[model samples]
Each structure stands twice: as C-alpha cells, then as structure tokens.
Target chain A: MKSDIILAGVGGQGILSIATALGEAALADNLLIKQAETHGMSQRGGAVYSHMRISDRPISSDLIPGGAADLILSVEPMESLRYLPYLSETGYLVTNITPFVNIPNYPDIEKVMEEIRKLPRFIAIDADAIAKEVGSSRASNMVMLGAASPFIDIEFSKIEAGIRTIFGRKGEEVVNLNLEALRRGRQFAEENR
Target chain B: MQKHLFLGVEAIGQGAIDGGMSGVYSYPGTPSTEITEFIQENPLAEERNIHRTWTANEKTALETALGMSYAGKRAMSCMKHVGLNVAADVFVNAAMTGVNGGLIVTVADDPSMHSSQNEQDSRFYGKFAMVPVLEPSSQQEAYDMARDGFALSEQTKVPVMLRITTRLAHSRAGVARKEVLPENQLSLPADPRQFILLPAIARRKYKGLLESQNLFLKLSEESIYNRYEEGAEKSLGIIACGIAYNYLMEHYPNGTCPYPVVKISQYPLPENYINRLDQECDEILVLEEGAPMVEEMLKGFFAKGTPIKGRLDGTLPRDGELNPDLIAKALGKQMFSGYAIPEVVANRPPALCMGCGHQDAYVAMNEVLADYSKGRVFSDIGCYTLGALPPYETIFSCVDMGASITMAKGAADAGLIPAVAMIGDSTFAHSGITGLLDAVNEKSSITVVISDNESISMTGGQDSSAFGKIESICIGLGVDPAHIHTIVPLKKNHEEMVRLFREEFAYNGVSVIIPRRECIQRASSRKRNKK
Candidate 1:
C-alpha cells in the first residue's frame, strides 16, 4: 500500500513531469501522497531529485528515509547511481542509458552502466531513442516513468489517464505520442524481465 | 470538499486568498517565489483584485504590505530567510507599531542553503522582533496557519510570522480548504500616534511590547497547533518542532511513540508542556530544524539539571538539515547502510545556461582580466554569482545582495586598482543602486559590471524591476555618461565586450559596463509561446 520513489535527472530535464503524472494517478486512487522537490538555483543545471511517497494511509515525512526507496527512477544514468544510498536492497533502479554531460568530470558511460548493472535489480533503457521512435524526443521522461510503472503501486490505466490530464494542454497529438512512448517503454521492461 | 494536491507555497497562497487577504506582496526568491506567483495566477485573487505583483525587493514588498494593513486590510508579505535581513529595519519596528488590520509576514528558510547564501532560521527574527511565529509541520498546516495567522495578528495588534523551511515549502501534499472570509473595511489604528515612533512614543510602544510577552505566551499555551502526547516510557521525552515533528513520526508508524512527546508548531516554547515533559521524563531530546533554538533555551548556560540534547550536544548535527534517517539514528535504532555510489557520478553543480549572457559576460571579463592578478572581481547574489564556478571562475567574492559594488569600492580604496564588481540587473535594482551612489559620491576607482539579463533569472525569471532603466539609473547616480558603456554579451561581440571592460577598468573613477541581453530561457520560452 506504500511506494517510495526517488525521481532523478539533471535540472530542467522534466523529471517533475513524471512525478506530477504519478501524483495525479495517486490522487485518482485516493492515496495519500507527499512529494518533496528541488527548486530555484538547482534547476539551472544541477543534479536534482524528488523524493515521492504514496500510501493508502497518511504519510508522515515529506522525505523518504535512506534505504527505504522502492524505486530509483532516473532519466540520466549517472544521476541514477547518485541515489544508490537511498535504494532498498530489493528496490528496482529504472534509469535511462543516456548521460547528461553538463559536468566536466563526467565518467565514461560504460563505467556508469557497469555500476548500475552491479545493482541486483535494475532496468536500463535508451528512453531518449524510444521516445524519438514514438515521436517527440521530449517525452523521454515519460518513457522513463513507464519503465518504472510496473513497480509503482498505482494502476497503469490510472497513469495513462494521469498523463492525459497532465498533457491535455499540449494537444492530443503530443498526448497520443507520449502514451505510445509509455507503452513502448513498458513493453521493453516486460520483455527484458 | 474535494481535496487537491498543492505545494506548500501554493497551499499558503490559496489559504491567504480564502482567508480574505487583500494583498500579497513579494520579490521572487527560490522556494518563496511560487507563493506570490500562485496568488497572481489565481482567478479568485484576480477577481478580488488583490494587489499581487513583484516588488523591487523584499524591503519594498514588506513596506507595501504594511501600507495595505495600515488601511485595515488583510495583507501578507513573503520573502526568503535572507530577504528578511533586507527588510529587518521595518520588520522589527512593525512589531512595536503593532497593526491596524491583519498582517502575516511569511519567511521561507533555506536549510542546506539550497538556493541561498546561508541556512539562517527565520524564527530567530521572530524572536528578535518579539512576534509570534507559526511553524507548520505539514502542508495542511502550512495552509491552516496562513489562514488563521491573519486572525492571530488582528487579535494581538501585531504582525504574525509563518516560518517554513525549504523542504516543506517545495514539497507537495493534500490541503483542505476553508470558507472565504471578507476583507476588513478601512479603519485606522485606535491610537492616533500608534505608528509614530518618535523618541517619547517609541519608549511607550517598546514597554507595551515587553508587557505583551505574557499574553503571547498564553496564546501559545492555548494554541491548537502545540500538543502534549503522553507515552508509557518516561526515560526520553522528545520535543519535535516544525517539520522535524514529521521526521519523528516517520520512525513510529503506528501513530504512537515509546517516549512522551511535545509537538510544537507555535513559538514561545509552550512552557507548560515543557514543564510537564521535564517533570515526567528523565531526559529530553530536542528535535528542531535550522539552529538549535529550542534546545539552547532548555539547556541554558549552566548545562542545567535534567539532561537536554540537540545540536549543541551533538545529538543532531549542528548544521545543514534533518531527515528521517538522522532521526532514526538519534533514537538508537539500527540504521540502514545502503549501497555506496561509485565515483563515476561526479558532482554536477549548478551552472549558467549555455546561451546565458552571464556566461558570455564572464568569458569576456576573464579574457580582459587575464593580465591582472585574480581576486579582483566581487559579485552579488544572482545567476552571475555562478561565475565563481569552474571553466570561468572569474568572481572573487559572493557576498550579500549589492555587496559587490561596495566591496569592490572598499578594495579600490585599499589600492587594489582596476577592481571589478559583477551584479545582475535585478540585483542592481534591488540594493545595488545605493552602493553605486556611494561609489559615485566618493568617485571611487572601481569598475561595476551590471550583467543585465533583463530578468531576475535566479528565481525563475521574474520580471526585472530595472528592466530598461539600468542605463538611466547609472546616469542618475552620477556616473559619467561617457563612462557608462553597454555591450551585447555574445561570442560574436567578445572583442567589443572586452574593450568595454578595459575602458571601464582604466577610467580611474566609478564606471559601469552593462552587458545587456535577454535571458535565453525566457527568450526561447517567449518564442515558443508566440508560435
């Protein structure tokens, strides 16, 4: 009845969009949700993460305790490994294979992937490529969310409806493309499993 | 009523709207920006014609809100913790002057210095000003306290402070709504000389404030926000304040704690419950965000009789922030050691955008200053403050708002010739004017680079107060017209920009070089919206 997720990415990468979609789904399911987000200077290009907790009962802390996160859903590979200290032993790390190369000392992508693969449970996807294939490269965050969807406590239908609600202003074409991207991401995760 | 998700800032804004706020005044700052933004965007607020607009700075915002309150209307002024320092002059005096209608001065503290220069607790300001401070532990309370805070102010004839930390301000949760109230009609203070702080009147008002301390304590004692919950164990009593209360609860999931607890959201320490906990329990653990204000009061200078623990005693780390894991460790519970992150994940500090004028401006400044030794550039708070970061670490000082020019002037006075001051346009408008005026009065030999990005940029591109007026502002401040130069900060104009800096540096008097360009983020977004 409870899910704790750490949504990670570079600032302005639209990780908040994925968090909002899940929040909307949690609301539809009548679950108590608390999401702690980073704002201001960090959004200029720093590494950022949102600690999201959803439960059938009231949640206490806005922050999830370290090692209690059931999922580390990251849109960037290196950013995903940054939050390993918060991931539970059985937690699933769903991250994009792409690297957000804003920092000068960003390590080799292969080593980054190797560290991620060391985790007992993880799903790495080229969410950017899948998003482009589904139309709209910006929807990669949605694809990252979809890859983590199976582990989320909320139903997939609720997430779909949530996306419709969130992207309603962007027009039907954008929403349809995002839904298709979500499906493709979910399919990839399912096939890999 | 249907429940809706809202960030703590948005919830406070919504609550203020429903609570009959006549005006909400602010200058945008991180975590605190969205409060005024929410009100400005709300249909209800617009329909009510509430005075919601970006102010020149936090001081102006506080004064404007006070003016609204003087006319007997409910008003709220908001700013980040450091912004409170900017408005401290009026803020302290307002407590002595008291109120005519209702006023809520909300200050959002940034622990961990998320987007600020320090992690100062605003509660200290409340204590210094001797006003009641309401610290909400939850988003719902963030709404409720803001809604009820106005009434508390009206009843006490003093402004009330609703303090929130970055986590609570930026976090999202479900907040219930209240019925809308009507704004107060125009009514001046009962006393004709209530607000007049002449030497004789100031003494009387200060005395009144000192006497009112008892009533303030009484209000805290009876406040619904402060509670005493009894537990079977008396070995360790916990006093959890503000958001720290939630972190304590995270450890005890069954809605019960083994230790007796006092949950404090209202200030003045709720002495009665503290006494009860002290009498019943052998020791006390004081859990509070920011500085160990409560813990210090309880511990006192002598180290006291009963053992009290917190930041000072290292029960909690003296700095940064508190999370649930730290709370668990404090309770002697076995802590979880999650997997360590590999060194591959390097630190990704915040930087100026790719096309940001600040970046190009720094590039040109760096090139121009290559001949001179480093540690000559002083900068203020803004995106340009990032010039202190790598690839273009050009700035030498990142102090308070507007300190750049004044500090540079001081350095020039100390024989550091060709001194440079870097500041953003919004920051220049905020407090940079007076400093520039000071430099001009003395004709100090310092070069001031007003990096005009045409937006606040730091706190998400709020409209700059001196958008198109920077040149005139400098002229009016007595800078020579010939010495005030403007350059477009782009790669194509790098040489021109460098030449401008060189000219200003050699001027032997107060000079300004305004590197003007619209913020790339706002520019691109505007283009997208136009399409």
Candidate 2:
C-alpha cells in the first residue's frame, strides 16, 4: 500500500538529506514518490518540512491532508507534534528526544522540554547522545531514523540503497560511519524490544 | 524507469526540461521559490545543461528571460503573482516584442494571500498583455503546460503566462516522467535592429502584435493543453479551470460529477470548448481563480445561460481566492458556516517576520522620524511594507510597484521635507532607478534610503539587481556618493542608520543611502548550512 509521509524539522538536522533518502528508498522499492520542500525558512533556524507522499497508484492533492498521515517522521520532538494532526490516530511517531530550543526570543531549554514531554505514541531516543557517541552530532536524525524505522513498512535494503544515494561519491569511511549509526540504532531497538 | 514521484515544483521544473526551455530565470518567492531552488539542487538540470539562476527580482528575471528569447533560445521566468506587478513594465512590453525563441512566464498566485501582500489573479496579466495563458489544474498538468507553454509562445509569437495557485505550487504529486527532448538551440537574430526598441521598428511590431488575435484564436482552438473532457452532459455543467478543476474533481469523484466539464487550461478564451459546454448545459458556473477573466469573456462571446455564478456577480466574494467549498456553495451545496467572518475593519494586518531586517528598519524609521506625521512614511512593496502594522505604523501609502520613492517626491513638491523613502535594492533597480532619476533631474528634495539587503527578501530572497552596484548607480544618477550610507539593519545600529537619514534629510537635492546587509532569511540559511 502507498502512503504519504511528511518529515518536518529545523535545518542543520539533515532534514533535506532525510527526505532525499526516504524518496530514494521508496523509489528503489518501485513505489511512486512525490516530495516537495520550502527552503526559504529552512536555512534560518526556522521550521522546515519535506512533504513526501509515496503511493502505488497515481494521486492528486500534493500536500498530505491535514490529519490523514500514516506516520509522522520527525527529527526533533516539537517538530513531531507540529505535524501531529497530520498523523492518523493509529499512526506511529518516530522522533528524537533532543531539544533544539534556539529560537531567538525564547532561550530556556528545560522549559521547552517540559511542554514537549506530553505527546502520545512517541518512540523517543537520546539521538543527540547517540550521535555524539558516533563522533558527529550531525547524525542525530539518522540515529532517530534508525530507532524508529522498524515500525515502518519500508525494507532495510531500500534504506541502505537510499543511504548510498545520499553518500554519493563520498569515501567508504563516510558511508560506513553512517551505516554503523544505523546499525547501532537498530540493535538498540531490537535489544530493548 | 522514470520515477512518478515528484513535487509539484519539481514537476514544473521537469516540465521546463521537457518543454525545451533553455533557461529558467527567477528570484525566490514563497511557493514559487522551490522551482528555481529545485532546478539548482537537482542533478538533471546540470545533465541537461539548463541555465537556471536566481535573479534579483521579478522584473530583472523577466528581462533576463526576454534576453534569452531575443538570442533565440526558449526562456521562462517565474515568480509569485504579486511579482507580476514588479515585472509588469518589461512584461507588458515583452508582449509587443514577441520573440525569436519561445518565452514563458509562470506566476504562482498565492490565493487566500498566504505568503503574500494581496491575493491577486495572474489572469489579468494575460488580458492586459494580450498573450495566450495557461493554468494547470494538477501537478501533471503543471508539468505538461510548462513543456507546452514554449510551443504555444512560439506558435503565437507572443509570451505565454502559466498561472498556478499556492496549493499547486507548493503541493507534491506522483508525476510520471517523459524523456527530455533536446531543446531548440537557436542563434542570434540576423538583424539586431528588430529588438532595439527604436520608435521606427517598435511601432511596426506593436501593430503586428495587435493584429495577432486571429492567430491566437486559431492556436487556442488547436490547443492540446485546454480541451473539452467528455462526460455525461446534464442540466448542470462544471467549468473548472486550473487548480479549481483539481479541487472540483476531488470533491466529486466518478459518477457523482457526471456532468460535462470544460477543462480550459490554455487561454485566449477557448471558444470551441465554451461553445460545446454552453450548448449542452442549461446552467454554467465558472470555477476559476483571481478575478472573473473567463467568466467575463464567456459572457462577451455568448450570453445564453442561466444563473452563471462566480467571484463576480455576488456568486462569490469579489476579493480573495476561490476554493471548492466556495464552488460547492455556488453549485447550491451547503458549506460549513464557520466562526462569523471577521469584518475588514476589525481584521488585523501582517507583522514583521519576528527577527527580520524590515522590522529593525521600521523601528529605526519610527524612532528617528517621529517629528513628521506618523502616516507620511514613503514605503515600497516588500516585507518592509509591514511597517504599516502596530508597534511601527510608519508607512502612509504603498501604491503601485515603485511609487514609494516618487510618492515621497510628490510630497516634497507640496511642502513635506526631512521626508524618507525606503525602497529595496531589487526594487530600486526594477523601477526606483527611473524615479530616482526624475527626482535628481527635477531637483525634488527627498531622502531615499535604498535598503540594500543584497537581495529581494520579500518574494523569498532572490538576488538583488544592484547586488554589487548600488553605490555606483546612485553616484551615476548625480547624487553625491558620500550620502550613500551603509548600515547593518540591526537594532543596535538604528542610530547609525538614523544618523545617516538625519544627514541626508539636510541635503536639499536627491540623497541616497545604501543600507547593506544580507536578507535575514538568506543569511540564516547560510549559517544553518555551515552547521
């Protein structure tokens, strides 16, 4: 079955890279993929989301319905809740437990986390800690994707292929390090299960 | 296998690839920005050797595309609908010149005024320019028309306008890809005299463009873009054009909407489709966006229909946008009556983009120029015009495109001094250049601050026309280059900007200050990338 998945987050968390990997993975599995983004605000510590809809059949309405999404893939906690209404009641939320509370006017991190701790159906991971352990804070979203991906219907092989597409022309080490992060996330999820 | 998954904006770019456009010149504006951004980000553009660049503003983007066409390469320019007004001068004139290669201009009309100053229809541009226009109902059609727009422009020897609403521009769809046709790479005109706008040749070409109605109508009849979709003809027919067709079909799938529909994507008022639609149906309801262009034209060509309902004639509100719910209401279906509609007087206006340079500029202007009447601020169109809001309700009138500068000049002539005109660098190049020239030539006393943010920040951070040359131009225009001050629009330096304004106010003749800074949006974008 084809479903539309929207990944929204602030930039620098690799949101575009995630959308690219997801689109490639879906395409590898032979599903139709349509993804669009708004970059004007993405670069400015502002909200950014990639609307990705994958379907087995042709479709209209490029934007996902306000609250009919099957899964909400978010890199940050607040971003997950930002698109919560788009998720179906039974929809799973795959997100990181880290707080990126760097908004200009509001600078209190713990205050922001207190509010975000209340969302339902959350599969939270200390992505920032996991990414730091992996030698790159930039990989936090990838670690979260690694943790939450088991709940998705997409195959691991497809994600691997998609990851290769993103690593494009880079050294084997660069690709292997990210692969290790994905493995760590998957291993943690299975062991916890 | 060609992938079907593509964004509406990506599909538009791919359509440009298929449509054989040699270049896509645009400045980023919300909704419409992704087209150029995607073109740059994607690998296909480079593989095809397509020339896609972010121009300074709508006018410069249009002019650049026009230059490409003059060189005999199919070219396209794109922007949000309000940008049409910025490019209207060159845009309206481009119709007269026509082109050797195809020229297509796409405007993403932000209906409901989302990410816009006003929700205006680009259809008016088609009627104003006398050019054939096309509006796509879906992402598939967005791609299809983008490719075909070139053919239509070339066949008619006039520029083509492709219009899409915010939904279509920002939406995503599974667009099946077609093989890219090699573009028609043409050479320069054998005679350069043809395009040089000298009165002798331009007069003749202008007449030729006016007499092209028959050819335009012929092309309209043969249009592959606009067609009559045959369905069961009933007492009621649906005339859904552009994205309205997409929403209407979604609202009534399969047998529910068995009534015949005239899906007029291409324009010049497709008479054949309208004639068939009019002959079969007893009543017609026009479901089009941004003004009653089609509805008005249909009445002009044929008058026999009952209860023709649309944006005009009180069928729908004459202002704002049209959606399926409105269409449903017009078709005698009940719609959700929401919270009592807020009255216009009671409605609040837009504010600055939280941490925007425009806000800083407005704060400085309000503080320094409090002596002048609060309503006397001469403002140009941009996010800076948001100063007309609370906290800094400094702008008086924001009429036309670049009238902010000249409107202040008129005030200066009538005994207003120490007056200020704030125009963006991109807009200064667009139309403010000539206005500044007039002020300098006639010796009108005005202090104009060319807020040189190095880009057009409003329509989504397109390049600035005076990107590196604002100072040179101001000096060339006979204003002392010393008065051309630069300041980072930070609140801490409001005094510096304010002091520069104070000094320029004393200067009797034309004075310009170049407040140089990168648009906060673009600057923040660069900062995020480094992380």
Interface C-alpha RMSD after superposing true interface residues, each candidate, one decimal: 0.8, 8.2
lDDT score, candidate 1, position B246? 98
In the predicted model 2, the residue pairs found to clash are A33-B5, A43-B525, A62-B172, B19-B147, B29-B459, B56-B463
Q: Model 2: per-residue lDDT, tens digit, B1-531?
A: 464655667778878877777889986676687787777776867887789877656888899999999888989898888889889999898898887788989888877765666787888888898898888877888888887778778788889998888777766656766767678767886567667777888899888888998788877778776777776756777788887775566446342477788877877878887888778888777888677777776664454545566766787777776654566566676543322211111111234555777777777766677755555669887767667756778788777567888998989998887667888887787778888888889888888877777777765666666788887888898877666677888878888877876777778888887666677778987798797
Candidate 1 lDDT over residue span A1-193, tens digit each: 9999999999989899999999999999989999999999989899999999999988999999988899999999999999999999889999999888988798999999999998899999999999888878998988888899999989999999999999999899989998988888999888875
Q: Where does the lowest 10-residue lDDT sum fall in candidate 2 chain B?
A: B339-348
For each candidate in turn, give its C-alpha RMSD to the true structure in angstroms.
1.0, 5.6
Q: Provide the overall lDDT of each model, using Cα atoms, as 2-decimal numbers.
A: 0.92, 0.73
Question: Can you give the TM-score per candidate against the true fold?
Answer: 0.99, 0.79
- Which candidate number would show the highest DockQ if scored against the true structure? 1
> How do the residues B372-488 of candidate 1 rate in per-residue lDDT, one tens digit apiece?
988999999998888887889899899899999999999999999989999999999999999999999999999999999899888877898898999999999899999998988
